[model samples]
Target chain A: MNGILLAMILALLIPIYEAWQDEDIWQKMLAFASIATKTSIMILVVSVLRDDWMIGLVGVLILSVGNAALMLLAHIIRRLNEA
Target chain B: MLENLDVVAIAALLPLTACMLVTQVDPYHALIIRGILGAVAALVYALFGAADVALTEALVGTMLSITLYAIAVRSSMSLRLGTLATAAPNLDAAVPSALGQQLFPALRQAIKKHHLRLEVLPYASPQALQFALENKEIHAVCVPAEQLATTQGTDDVAAPYLLNVRIPRLYETLAAALPPELVAVSFSRALRLTSAAPPPPDSQLQNALEG
Candidate 1:
């Protein structure tokens, strides 16, 4: 269980590194979305380990709503660029 | 065997490595990498028995973000510019100081100010330009100021700005951005002005009719 948790922690590092390296606005936004998803997944994993549905609920909410809003924002920005 | 920590560690490592490599790629490829990152994360969540989280990641992170990024990339602003061939000297030159040189800065200003994607094309003669305009091949045309003067009595010559009638709003935007001395003439008037010249041999319409 500890090893699985450690792996989850390590998994979170990728998006951080990607956001740091990428310069384009779209790529950066994508990296942030990745980070958000990973973080929510980590939350869910931790909640499952503790058998706490409350934290898991939070994770599910983030997973469902967070990236959708972010992508919508991206679309708006893209339309602005087109205009 | 499936519960072994080593297996889980390896699974997580694969995705982590993929995410790291994603940052090294160009923007276009980076988009794909980002999708992969989301998928791998979802897979990791599933392995850890976080089914809800995994499903969310797959839908939002992989599908939604990728679609949005694709739309953003696709929606980049584009403008097509047609110029008299002789007016546009060798653009390949290290420092081109031709008649079209002055226009470049204006175009650049418009792009930088509005984040526009512009393409510059050249026409061999006025007739070819007219044909191209009629076929909706270009958005705007730039002829030499002198050419406009010589074509006097034909129609109003805007000296540099002749916009397509299809996009009246573009005329306002371009007129405001371009030099004041440059006037904006309608497509029909511009066509009539150029009609004084003979037609070119190589156009899609002509090619189809001849062939």
Candidate 2:
């Protein structure tokens, strides 16, 4: 059975896999950034309204870091897709 | 109160609780619902009063949700052999601990009984415990839940009485704290509870076991 952590790991691996597939520095970076950007918006929406500020803050920080990784990947993927 | 869990634990528990919140939805929707719920929580912080945290959450969550959703959407394409209930790894970990689980509660109870504040330290080896004492993370070397068993005529380690706080049997106290589903039938998680008696010269329960 997939425990919660396993599921979460799988969830995280998606953008990483996509960036690897693109083979271009820029496209991969952008795609990676897009994923992060989308997730951050979601987190910001959530955090703006939570009872616990710290929890909301933690979620936001995690998303931001993830997106930054994707931004690096986004450049690669975009280039590969164009070529 | 969900007192047993620390903040990080609660963060994990909250998303899982979505199973109850969206009983009728498909798993994808359930995930979305959870994300949305988290987002809603963030919004509350932003709008109601905690803008600093709201800003912090806003940036990180945007990235995190991307990762989670990307994975979820991709996983849907595969012909997984089992459903989510059976397919996930490490499901057995859901069964919580039995003995050591009470270590915290027992300590707390002892402190409260004496009208004292509560502080907890990590479990460590004797050397590590010594280090912790030097660092002042712990004032005493706490004992395991097991009784202090001893054989005569050997050198028994004299027990130290730092503070007079007697912890009840592990089986007795945490028994109440756990859900009915998690209690194991035999040889629960407390490592010390079932060990052989320490021969006199080596048994530290001779001195430091009592707090």
Candidate 3:
């Protein structure tokens, strides 16, 4: 669980790191999105750390739904490619 | 419809678009389509109530279509689609190191200290930098030590400033709003980088000779 949380935070930083290095349009977009998601994760982490069970539960639920959608999108793309 | 275009931009784009539609459908071809769409879209935005969507759809549609078409072509050519897709932003362990951030402030400081007349453009690249210099828009570039050698005048012109700097993280550049890659190379009315005349004699050396 802690490892998963760490992975999420790292994901946010990678873009910020990339944005700093690259001046390309695509690189910048990736960076902005990274910062936004990182900020969101911080809020979620703080809520969990505070033992606010309600908010933490909501955060988890949202994350799960988002992750599921991403997986679903990947599957759809794969099928599209095959078709 | 029939509004708001320089004859030049239109002329450049028309044949370019027609050629792409008829022949090689590459990413650059999409760029021509995008410019055409953007111009058309801007007109539609001005004409009707849906200005924002019109603006977005015009630009987005052109760019996305170009990208999608390009991707499809690449796929047909057996190139992987994974390269086309951008990953979602994730912020798991971003500590925000200052190394990446300092390049901008260091540039600003150089400009300020030198009293240089330079303005970094939006979306400027090294090639653009060389072109601007070639056209005499600006005189000098304050870039990384590595970039100095790439200047057009290494054979004739002597670059006086090759500033090495470490800067602080000034903003959340993750937004890409900052023109970080855009470094200005400037010159006074006096120190032209591409001057046809021979360089002025060194002031200290001249004074010593006279003395």
Candidate 3 per-residue lDDT, tens place, B15-49, comes to 44344335423332333334333333332332333
Model 1 Cα lDDT, one tens digit per residue, B1-211: 5556644663765556574645453444456556556655764665566667777776777778777776675554557777665433674332223334666667667655555666666776777877787788877765543344344433544343443433566666776776645444443424534434322213423676989
TM-score of each: 0.46, 0.21, 0.20
Cα deviation in Å at residue B109, candidate 1? 2.0
Docking class of 1: incorrect
Residue-by-residue lDDT tens digits, candidate 2, B62-112: 336645654554433221110011122453322113223543344455433
The TM-score obtained for chain B by all candidates, in the order given, is: 0.50, 0.24, 0.23
- TM-score comparison, 1 vs 3, better candidate: 1
Q: Which TM-score value belongs to model 3?
A: 0.20
Reproduced native contacts, each prediction: 0.00, 0.03, 0.00
Q: Rank the candidate models, highest lDDT first.
A: 1, 2, 3
RMSD of 1: 12.6
lDDT of 2 at B197: 28
Q: Which RMSD values do the candidates have, in order?
A: 12.6, 21.0, 22.6
> In model 1 chain B, where is the ten-residue run with the lowest total lDDT?
B195-204
